[model samples]
Target: MAIVVNLDVMMAKRKMSLNELSEKVDITLANLSILKTGKARAVRFSTLEAICKVLECQPGDILEYVAD
Candidate 1:
């Protein structure tokens, strides 16, 4: 996949656990886990916004585009 999700990296940098972020973002752990593992097919803008808000980072910090 050209798009990469760097959720774990940011979480480590922020010293936050997945469970903590899940609660803070008001998202289910299972859904957040799917996203963290880069298994998600799509992410809603609202969801992205909520994650960014909780992580104190931009969308670019979570998602990256690499040419194949």
Candidate 2:
């Protein structure tokens, strides 16, 4: 199974930067980078909610499932 995070794609579509998102989401750059790079093992619902609100996107827009 493979789960892909389209964070960078959404950020680009929204014309937002890493640092900007970090500040808006109140997430550390390191942690956000981990999530953005699809290295995160998990993410809290609240964190996800904040991201969605800040980016004006849905969780489905940032997440994808692939059969491997």
Query: Model 2, 13-51: lDDT tens per residue?
Result: 999999999999999999999999999999999999999
Stretches of model 1 off by over 4 angstroms after superposition:
none
Candidate 1 lDDT by residue in tens digits, 1-68: 99999999999999999999999999999999999999999999999999999999999999999999
Candidate 2 local lDDT, residue 62: 93
Clashing pairs in 2: none
Q: Any runs in candidate 2 off by more than 4 Å, and if so which?
A: none
By TM-score, the best candidate is 1
Query: What is the C-alpha local distance difference test score of candidate 2?
Result: 0.96
Summed over model 2, clashes come to 0
Most accurate candidate by lDDT:
1
The lDDT of model 1 is 0.98
| lDDT of every predicted structure (CA atoms) | 0.98, 0.96
Clashes of each: 0, 0
